[model samples]
Target chain A: MPNAQRKTSKYVDGRWSIVSSQRPKAIRALLGVLFLALSWVGAQSPAEITKQVQANLEKSPWEATVSGKAQLPDGSSQDVEFRLQVLPGKEQVARVEFKKPGSLEGNFVVISEKEVWNYLFLTNQLIIQPRAKANVQGLGVNLTSLGDFDQLNEQVSLKLLGEERTAEGAAWKLSGTPKDKTQGYSSMEILVLKADPRPLALTLKDAGGKTVADLAFKGFKRVNLTAKQLKKYPADAEVVRK
Target chain B: MMPNVVHGVPNAKRKAQDAKRRTVWVVRPASYAVRQTLNAPSLGARGEAAGGEGWGGVFHHGPRATGHRPRAFCFWLPAIGHRLSAIGDFRGGIFALVVAVVAHVLATSQAQSLTVGLFAAPGYISPTLEGSLELGGFSLSARLKRDSLGLGVEDDLEFGPAGRFVFGARGDLGFGLQPLAWGAEAYLRGSVAQFGLDARLGYASAPRAALWAGERNFSGFAGNFNASYRLDPANTLRASLAYAGDVPGAIFQGSTLGLEGSWALREGGATYLAGLGFRVGAYALLGWRGELGEEGTLLDATLRLGWVNRLELGLFQEELRLRLMTTFPLGGVPFEAAASLEAESLRGDVAYDNANGRWTVWLRYTFTFD
Candidate 1:
């Protein structure tokens, strides 16, 4: 009877060990399939990524505070603080405060989805200009006050030039050209985060193959903004409606 | 009684002839009376200063015995009247003809005229057309334009699409002072976007001569001093320095320097133009926000072929353009309509706003008046 009990226990222990050995191999196979699927999804064109980003940006209204230093063309540097409020299915509004080191100091411009208002802080007056004609002169980039993604595609051709890891370690890389020959931009590169496919950086170059502007976004916080916060532009700030 | 006197005069004449074989004759008072009654209007003495001899001395006196000479009094009156009337009529007719010819010549030389128009592209592309009429050293011009674009936004946002259509009128008064050409223009522009007041001063030193200085709202304080020598009537080689900059509140302020040359083949109608340009300095100073710099180098080449009737075909890079244009009699109004198809290959890295590699169709139109 003692020998029979010992044989039964040994048989059970061997069976459990065999099942454990086979399970690990099955799990490895499943993991391999999942990785291949993820890579295939990452290889989509920029148009595909644009569609996805547009859909996601439209899904919710978010607020973000952005702070950065820009290198100006004159070899000078300036610190910029930007406050942005985006409303889903509506226009995005932003207030930018600019501060330079010396004699160059003023509260100048306000941009909404439809218009751009220039404030002369000294005289406390605002100059409203059409969003279409407003000259925001850093890099000849004319942001359409009411442009859609499809219209943007018309202005600049979007192509998925393949994925690349940017110097700043972005999630995805997208490259494109200005389909409109007259659009001053020579080409565009967008660095998007892989986790949410959000654009983290954008660079604009002129027709002469020189970098005109480079923008990077840091500390992005996705928050549901209130309607009141979205309307933060000053009432006296001259509104320029398209 | 007169006959008796004349008989006495004959007896005296016979005695005088007998006494004067040496040719001496005497006439009495009765003979004088008879001469006076028969003499008609006297013919003025011929060669009076030296009236020494009569014609050949054939008779040595007037006709002696002729019947009364018949005179046609009515014929004289009518012939004189007819000649005088004809002379008067011809004088009046010639004056009227001269006046009519002068009026016709003046009317034919006095007509001169111009027209302009503008159109828009599908995207934020705008082009302009202008026409001018030159008359008596002055040119009046009309300009039309369509501009579509987004307004003001910072580096991070997507610009919305907006557009404006503009129509303007300008008058240029030019003076051709030999080695120097000078002109000034005053313009008023009205548009759906903004109202503008424009004034310009221009000086050009001949067509091939290098220096030009002009100011326009769009081009800013622009000066182009290019030294060009004509290789032939159809080709030119040029080296130039050009500068243009805008003030703080103006539209475009970038400055650039360029080197360019043009060649014409098969006459001036077909041309090949090539240019290389580099941006030189700060484009603008936007207050304390930042300074915009004009940075880059551009290389461009274009070939244009024109037909006899002012039809042009242009091949530029990957673009093909066909245009039809003509000038009419009234003020040299030229109407040009063009269509183009462009396919371009792009490779480079651009600071990104919101564009990926893509393809699109572009259409543009413009008009010029002169």
Candidate 2:
């Protein structure tokens, strides 16, 4: 559930080039001096930066619509679109709806309190499963785990990978290496906007250093939801047993 | 109401008040549900104290203060009557049966929710309708499923409070219209949490194509026990053992044990531009056919890929059997189209070697309304 996205096969590791090439020689020297001064003033630790990102997520209830593509090992790619609505409270609820592909258009999943309700619109089948089975790995952006610093730390090691300006804005780049090798991906890089600590993008890689997926985030905003509206999500659906 | 996102301006005061109002709306219902759970009688414990089955001992679990539950059946009588009067139209009768079950569930349910869905393939169509009602610590659920092969109605009643063990009984009636066979099944599910037991006692004589578990022309009891372990957030290990036998006859017409592990290898995502996802899994099954005194083993591997979160293709194989399945949108009102092709080939030196192939196509649509 880390704010990680699987990179498409088209992904090229540009971190080294961006760090090595983009800046002008004068600005590079000035930035080195600024870094020395900032070091003297005590820069934020990787843990602190990761926590700040988590805090930014916990600041309110928010919803985001993410769209991206996944490139398969076969070299074919699939389109992906989903809306993530996070209802924060005593029992946090995250609802995801798969859009775009006509086949999965009405597929909906709701997770709360260690349980998940997966509704397959095509079959009118609602499958109830344990929440542990609902990990949001490789999904580009994990809204449910955005505020879960403990979960992130438990699963992977975090390190600040320096900074750069993206299409969005100036940001802090961080790398995560899974503590357990069995995870979906070997490592991931995340970009967080420095101005607001908002996560902007995630790029994941395999152990061979090949790009797996790239996820970009946009349209993040808070929405006030009434209790009735929140409760209506899972409570009304009839439970179907297989 | 939160301030609308217009152009790029932030209206702070309105958003803050809207946040407060939203908080109240969510908290109230949650608190009410909690209160209701606390006030309800411990239905599971009572059922255990009185022993399972036999209503004469104690019917406490039957019909709660919600008298509307029993009254819910009133709505079904008329529809059932209509089906009985038009017995020749068995398909229509099956459709009415599903509607009645949904109506009954809605009438008795505090939430009054019903779910309906269908899956169709060349030469086959299966539609399912279900409804559930909750009263105190007890819940009643009814489901009706009909397909080209057969029709089945299952009723389940479970009792337990939240965060505790649950116990349930199920009654099932199955009709095989094609072969004109009828069957019934009774079972207990989740009777003990540590055991993860679900046992069904059944009597069936339906054709293999129309019967459950592909059991043909047999009357017997069959059930399976399942258990699972979570290796991590993304991996789950599961195993099950099953037993089936003919009634007043062979105690083991068939027995099987299977194990499966599923990993969420690569989760897919999408935005307005592009999306993709993939997962891989493998499982093994070993079984014995007592009647034929034959033993067999099956190993299966599967891979699923999604393109733009729109098209999905699944490839599966077991031993000499190979299958490919696909589901993609047809673009007309978001229609979903599915196709499956399977082939089984004989291997090893044999006097006569041959292979069999099967294929099916399906179109599906889904809708939801209060």
Candidate 3:
């Protein structure tokens, strides 16, 4: 009763701090629980983050525009731009239409569950082959792999690197090491937005730490897509199947 | 057929579109073109000879001579790279074929691949070269050699992403009888978000070669401007304008203006990401047309019915123009060849306009590299 009437308190930093026995235990316990909850959210493993991103993207048929820089197998950097439309289902199909690096303009690659179709605008020709035999082009980094975290993990080992304060808020960074030593690059970096937990940018570096690709994902939208929509082409285009 | 609104849409929607389409009837009898050629003199005086060899090939032959113009047949000889040559004299086609063979045998390596092509009517043969190269993300394409009536050496340079952009230039230097004809053009193109833009400007003056000559001297500025937006992956709306050159239906050969708004769609599995657009530029000729002057109309229809884009049937007059586009890649060759019997007119009749008809068969072969 005497301490409650003359509560002891101390001033610390910018605010006054109460270090007294008069505080309610229930309120203190609630604060502790809130802190723990926040810490738990922040402590998600890198693998969990990757899984979350994959699930979020696969929730529907989505389309996004990817534009940035990529490193070629020959160790040269190319400006890369393409439109990616993914229709996820039992018979999933994804189409990537390139608009950048002028060489591959109007070209597209369609990956389905069973096979892949590659169309070259310059030749007005379409080449269809089994996915197992299809070669990864436009950069050794497969454009379609980012949507599948497990596949990407096999290509490059990923770990939670750090988080950085961004204009929108904060973002987590994932640093990855390519498992294939034969590739020109050594490591990669991905920035994921914390607000929505989606990937924002990806950067690949050569063995010397030279930047290979620095692609930023933008104009992402979740929409209903069909296989026929992804398979659109010039009616007169040449089709070749192997 | 390329649907205007049918320019692109689902099959069901395209079928419901009210657009222009046509089937060209090529009656290439010895006497048929002779009758069409009889009216050539008046057309040439009107400067319509600039069209050179589409209604019947009267202009493709030098000095406006007309007698026993044997209907020409084109032969396909695959060369290394991509190039399109125009209207042929069979002998010239034969010569180009031999040259193409020699070029293929000599330069089939990653070093230097050559493109050889020939197009023939009864009196003229035009050959051309189109080739491309890709290094990293940088790409450069060039179409060298021009027929008497064809555009010469269109060069396209692209460096992109980081921001997508393309710079292209096409021009010609002609050593002809008149003041040595010359033309130059530069264009810029970019795609961002859902919008796309392309603009081009150029100037030209005629060499005045008789049929071998350019009749109309486009001595002033010519340009084409286009803007497009994608409503989605399946639908696109585009608006284009061509000044002092791309007259509608190409009714005026010299320089006229054209403005068009078109919507295109994609819905078939085989037609996926293939070449589909609103305007089917030329009826008898099928392929992508870059020139604004050659924009086709609603009366023009090109039907491509095939399995996997392999077999194409042009239902426009039972292949009267012999337009065949196929990519039967044998043994994983990844090459393509096209031969079309084309007869173009200099009017806007839209009903098989053979009024000032110019006939020429065009053959194109494309070579590819990864």
lDDT of 3 by residue, B131-233 (tens): 4433233333333333332232222222211113345454554432133445656666554435565566766553111112212222345665666565654
- Least lDDT summed over 10 consecutive residues: which range in candidate 1 chain A? A233-242
Instruction: Give the least accurate 10-residue stretch of model 2 chain B, judged by summed lDDT.
Output: B24-33
Ordered from best to worst lDDT, the candidate numbers read: 3, 2, 1
Best by lDDT: 3
DockQ, prediction 3: 0.05
CAPRI band for model 1: incorrect
* Tens digits of per-residue lDDT for model 3, A1-242: 22211211111111212422345777656655654564556565667788777777777899888889877544677788888899887778999988776546566888887777776543334556567756545554654454777677678777775676666567777888978786546888888777777788888887788888889888888888999888765433334443
Candidate 2 wrongly placed segments (more than 4 Å): A1-37, A40-42, A71-75, A133-147, A226-238, B1-370
What is residue A94's positional error in candidate 2, in angstroms?
2.0
**TM-score, candidate number 2:** 0.38
For candidate 2, write residues B327-363 as lDDT tens digits: 2222211122223232222211101001101122221
> Candidate 3: where is the Cα deviation over 4 Å?
A1-29, A72-78, A167-169, B1-370
Candidate 1 per-residue lDDT over residues B24-86, each given as its tens digit: 111111111111000000111111001111110111111111011101111112322333344
What are the iRMS values of all candidates? 40.6, 17.2, 14.0
**Model 1 spans > 4 angstroms off:** A1-28, A65-81, A91-114, A120-123, A130-139, A145-151, A164-170, A224-242, B1-370
Evaluated on the second chain alone, the candidates' TM-scores are: 0.26, 0.37, 0.42
